[model samples]
Target chain A: MLTFKVKRRIIYLGIFCFTLFLCFFYVIKTLNQSLLYFKTPSEIFDDQNLDLSKEIRLGGMVKKNSIKVNKREIQFIITDLKKEILVSYKGTVPNLFLEEKGVIAEGKLKDKKFFIANRVLAKHDENYKPPSENQLDKK
Target chain B: MMRNLFSLNKIYIFSEKTLTFIKSVFPVLLILGLTFALVLSPPDYLQGDVVRIMYVHVPSAWIALGTFSTLTVLSIINFIFKIKILEIVNLCIAPIGLLFTCLAIITGSIWAEPTWGTWWAWDARLTSMIVLMFFYVMIIYSQKHIKPKNRSLMFTSIISIIGAINIPIIKYSVEWWNTLHQPASIKITGETSIHSSMLMPLMLMLLILLLYSALIFLMKYKTEIIKVKRSGVKRL
Candidate 1:
């Protein structure tokens, strides 16, 4: 009887997990096809698991003086301190999108490091501040 | 032995016990759930009919938090009162809360992207729900790392209580802060924030969800009882 009960619990747990697993993937993959997974430049070049065909987002702070625009196409560089990615966009840009600010560019890669953006999202949560030195000293 | 004393109830005193209770309750819940499903529940006036999803959303949210709260208190009871039943109750509620939390997040997410223009926002409710989900998964996963004895319950209860402080924050955050999430459409004021026509199906669906939640709650609790009984027998 104990064996039967343990077996039942294990089976139920397995069933619940399997269902959630399926639902999670169904939602993610559907979102993946429609939208894009935001990834950093270093995450891509460092050889992470990412779908190449589907859309993706390249996010980082815009490197200083790395912006170039010619008619419909705009090119810029995104830096994550150690490395950077050349990003180009072919559509309307977000209002707050510009140099030295954190930007998330949605598209796919073209060359080894070049990103073609279809949509862009500007960073909104910018009130980040470190606790004062006095607070740290108290701790 | 404790089961015998409670068996002599007022109304349903059939000796053919376990099967009898299951048979009776099962159809009632099924009928209640089925009737609401049939009504097709008229659309909410403001949200239109899409708000019928609230039927599922609210109960899941309710049960999700309710189950977690139950778990926390039972865990505390197990520690303080040293009640063995409370410990089992705490264990049983953990995964049940996780299940409802999963349901709540998914239903909320599906409803969110359509109306809110995005699947998720960093509003207090959504943020806390994400953190709750993370904590749920972490607690469940960390169960393996913990000793099988009651030592894990102490730490788990602490985590549960700490996470619970956020529930009130989530409830009031919409009022306190600027948020994309709309405030509660239904309220205690009785001014009928939603149209009367929509209220019927909405209430119906709410009933269905409550019944469904109770049904699942009983099912999970029953199975948990069996497990505890089995484990006790093993130790014997």
Candidate 2:
């Protein structure tokens, strides 16, 4: 039969375990933040504390003639209203990885000031896709 | 007798049980706390009102790693102790962990598009999260197809433990390579670390997220237990 001492030990032990998991969980929760989560090419280079494991989003135009593809890796340039940034990828190119298209690459930013993309999503012109030749008449 | 062997009331009688409860409730409370920080806590001088999103975005990212850490530690513990609860906990944690990881990626992107002038960057954290997302998918996929009774828990626990490699990958993601995001905050030790004002909200949000995680863990654990209990019964 289980004695009171045994049961008490179990209770105390459970509480101790709970506290420990909470503490470790808290450490990750509280401390893992950054001054910034996104970066333009200029900002990527400007900030000195950049890291590799962190997740980031890089946005810009797919510079014409700048894109280079080999196997799964693709490299291109992104530009804002002001400056240009270089980006590299080593995965299936998102369908919209075309020149002059607005693209957002999801991947890592390197210390080299270049971004290594893993996925890409293209932006369509806000003007909206033209209706199929017949859809215009459906209205 | 077996039901009474480790009953609900008996949960208080086991250290593992207590750990389970705390693990379950932590995430929910953390999420609520994040909401508070976002609405009530101080805002960033530069980002203003919108800055509040950072509180949620950052901690969600934080917990994504932490949740996976649970998988890692519990999996290791599972290997060492062969406890049933650890496997249950790991299964329950995966869905929420993946959700938070996805949330972090999405929210971070929204924040970046404006502030950084781009929608995405191949930063250290960003890449790892994508990896984290893949891990989450594989874990969930494995859990679904694997035999429920055939040492799957042990195998999954091992998977969870091994998956822990991502945490370090995430932690050092910024350090090992060059990316656009900054380094650790509460855990960092550099001369130019996060300011207290930022830290205050971050802390509050983190507490909320911790609570939130526990809440999530418990909710899922309870449901899983119920599923287990029903597994053997046939209803006519």
> Against the true structure, whose DockQ is highest?
2
- With candidate 2 superimposed using the best TM-score fit, by how many Å does residue A135's alpha carbon deviate from the native? 58
What digit string (tens of lDDT, one per residue) describes model 2 on residues B166-195? 678688766554355545544546343444
Worst 10 residues of 2 chain B by lDDT: B42-51
TM-score of each: 0.54, 0.55
**Stretches of candidate 1 exceeding 4 Å from the true structure:** A1-139, B1-40, B142-145, B188-192, B231-236
Best-performing candidate as measured by TM-score: 2
CAPRI verdict (incorrect, acceptable, medium, high) for model 2: incorrect
TM-score of candidate 1 relative to the true fold: 0.54
lDDT of 1 by residue, B107-193 (tens): 887776544335665555676677777767666655436787666765676576556655665565555543445555665675555
Chain B structural similarity (TM-score) per candidate: 0.77, 0.78
Candidate 1 lDDT over residue span A1-139, tens digit each: 3456556645654574477556755753564432322456776788666567877667678889998999979899988887788988887665446677667777888854788888666542212112242256569
